[model samples]
Target chain A: MRHTIPPRSGAAFTLERGQRLTVIDPEGEQVADLLAFSRSDIDEVISSGRSLDYASRIFLTTGDALYSNRSNVMLRIVEDTVGRHDFLLTPCSADTFRILYDDAEPHRGCFGNLAHALAPYGIGPDRIPVAFNVFMNVAVDGDTGALAVRPPLSRAGDRIVFEAETDLIIGLTACSAPQSNNFAFKPIEYEISS
Target chain B: MRHTIPPRSGAAFTLERGQRLTVIDPEGEQVADLLAFSRSDIDEVISSGRSLDYASRIFLTTGDALYSNRSNVMLRIVEDTVGRHDFLLTPCSADTFRILYDDAEPHRGCFGNLAHALAPYGIGPDRIPVAFNVFMNVAVDGDTGALAVRPPLSRAGDRIVFEAETDLIIGLTACSAPQSNNFAFKPIEYEISS
Candidate 1:
C-alpha cells in the first residue's frame, strides 16, 4: 500500500524524512546488513563505519553516518544496539576463489562483488578502490583478552536513519562472520530515511 | 599446496564452470547466499535480482565472463567450494562512524574487513556493489504447497575450478541463509582455483 519495506513481523513501514523503522532480528543476535546510496542516484555507495571499535554494538544509534565517495552524506545512526561498529571487513576479490577452482591466476575478493554490481553504470572493479562496513561488528582477541573490536552499546531492535545524498542502490545481507561474538552466524535488521 | 579444497566432513561442493560460480545449498532445505564477481572491476552489482535477470541465470559464476559498462570482462571464478568462499556483504559509511562514536566509525564487518585488508590497493565501497546470491534457495512460501523447492545435492568439500574469462576480482562469504532448511545458519565452506 505504500512505498516501503515490510517488517519480518508482517507490517509495512514507509521510509520518509525523519521517519524510521526498526527491523527486529527476534533472535538474541542479529547482524543488520545495510547498504545505502544517493536518493537522487541509486548508484552512489554510502560511506559508513565504526570508530571506538566496541562489541555488541548497533548502528544508526547516534554514532555512525552514511557517506558517499563524492564525500556526500547519506544516513546517520540515530540509534544503536551492541555498542561499537567496524568498517573493516568489507568483501572484495582476492586469491581465495582462484585457488579453490583450479584456475590460472589470483584476484582481489572485495572488489569482485562490487564490480559485477556496477555494470549498468559503466564502472569497473578497477574503479572500485574503497568501501564501508555499516552495522557489522567485530571482536579482535589479544593476548590478555578479546579486544573490543568496536564500541559496546547497541542492543537489539536499535535504529538508524540517513538522508540520501542522491539516488542510491542498496544491497543488504546479514553476515555469518567467523570472527564475531561467536562463529555462529546471526540475523539483523535496519531502516532508512529520505 | 594441493589445488584441491579438502572436504570438510559436513560441507558441500560445487563444480563451477561457464565463468560463473553456482553455490549449491547442500542442506537442500536451506537457501544459499551466493557472492562472487570479476576482480578486474568493482562497480558492477551482482547481488540484485534485476541485474541477474539482465545477465541471465548465468549470474556471475566462477567462470561466467563478467562484462563491465565498458563491456570489459573482469576476472572469473577460478574455483569453488560449498564450505568456503569469499562473498561480499555489510559495511559502514562515513555517516556510520559519526553516529556510533565520538570520533570515526570502526572497520569490522566483511566490507570493512575487506577494505582494511586491501586498502593498500585503494579499493573502497564506492567501487563495489552488493554481491549476488547464486544457487541460493530462498523459499517464500505462498498459500500453495505447489512450490516444492528442489533439494541442493552437493558433496561436502567438492570443488570447481574456472579459467579466467578476463582479469577478475572475486569476493566471497559463506552464507547463513535459513529460508530453505530450518535455517540453522550452518556454515558452508568454499575453495577457489586459478
Candidate 2:
C-alpha cells in the first residue's frame, strides 16, 4: 500500500513480516514521526532505549534493528538516505506547542494524529508512545549536553526503508509543528510493500 | 475503593476529579510504577518530561504537579511520605530483563502488567507510557553520568498521595525485577477516595 499523508495528518496500516515500509520526505526538510507495534502483542512496541543499547550507538543507520521493549526485533533498517533521525526526543504534542510557542491554539501535533490514526484499532491516547522522529534534526550540545532541535538536513526525495521482522501496525504522522522551521509544514510520501 | 496489589502483578481503577489516590509501600523496599490517563481523553496521559519541566526539577516531591503531554495538570501531589520518587526512567520491560540479566524467562515486568491491567478497558500495549517509578532508587553518577539502580530508600509505611485534577484511569504495578534487591518482591497497598 502507498499513501501521501498530508501535513498535520497521519496514516496507519498493517505491515506483514518481511515487508518493507519506505518513508520519504518528498519536499525535503519535512519531519515525520514513525511509530509501530507488534500485531499480536501491542505491548512489544519499539523501544529507543533498547535499540540504542543493542546497537551501542546514539543514532541509527542501515542494518540496525529496531528492537522492542521486549528486546524482540521489530524492524530492520534496510536502507537510508538521511542518517540524522532522532530517537531520543518524544513526539511533538499539544503541550509542546503550549510550552514552546506559548500558544493555546489547537494546532495539530503528532500525538493527536497518532491517536486518531490508531483509534480504529482500539488504540487510544494513552497508548501513543514516543515515536522515531524521522528526518528530524536534533543535535546534542557537546559542552552542555543540551538537545537542540534544528531544521531537517534531508534533501528532496530522501527516504529511509525498514523491513518488518514481525506482523506489525505502523503509524506515521507528518509533523506540523512550526518549530521545525519558520515556514509551513509540508506533506510526506510513503509506500509499504512485501 | 482500596486494594492490595500482589508482587509481580498490577491493578487498575478509575479516579474521578477531586478524588485522591494514595499508594503505600507497606513492606517498604518494593517499587511500583504509577501511570494515569484522562478519563475523557486517553491521549492526555501523564508525561514525565512535562511534569519535570513544569516543576523544574528531576525528582518529584510534595506539591509538584504531574503534567500531561498537553501541559494540562493531571494530578497534584498533596502529600508524600517518601520524597525521593523517580519520574524519569521508564518502567522495566521484558527487554530490561534480557539486557540486564540475560534471562529470557517470562518474568513479570511493569510494561506487561500495565498492559494486562488496562486491557479490560480496551487500552492495549501501545498506550503504556513511561511510568513514575515510585520508591525506586536510581542515582546518576556524577563522573560517569551513569544511572545506578539501587535498593529503595523508602522504609515501611512510606506512601505518596496525589489529588486528581481530572477524572483518570490509574494503573499501578508492583515491580518484581531482581534489580531491586535479592529479597522477594513485596505487595503494595493503595486506596482511592473522593
What lDDT does candidate 2 reach at residue B92? 69
TM-score to true structure, per model: 0.35, 0.69
| Per-prediction backbone clash count | 204, 5
Global lDDT of each candidate? 0.37, 0.78
For B58-155, candidate 1 gives per-residue lDDT tens digits of 22444443333333334344555532221222233233344434435342323443344344444554454444333342221111101122333334
Segments of candidate 1 deviating more than 4 angstroms: A1-23, A48-64, A92-135, A139-167, A191-194, B1-194
Candidate 2 local distance difference test against the native:
0.78
> TM-scores of the first chain across all predictions?
0.52, 0.95
For each candidate, give the interface RMSD after superposing the true interface residues on Cα.
16.8, 5.5
Per-residue C-alpha lDDT of model 2 across residues A66-134, encoded as one tens digit per residue: 887667889999999988776655667777777767877857578888888888877666666557788
RMSD for each of the candidates = 17.4, 5.3
lDDT of 1 by residue, A11-130 (tens): 112234454434444343434344444445544554321221221222224544555543455555555544344442333233323323343664332244444445455543344422
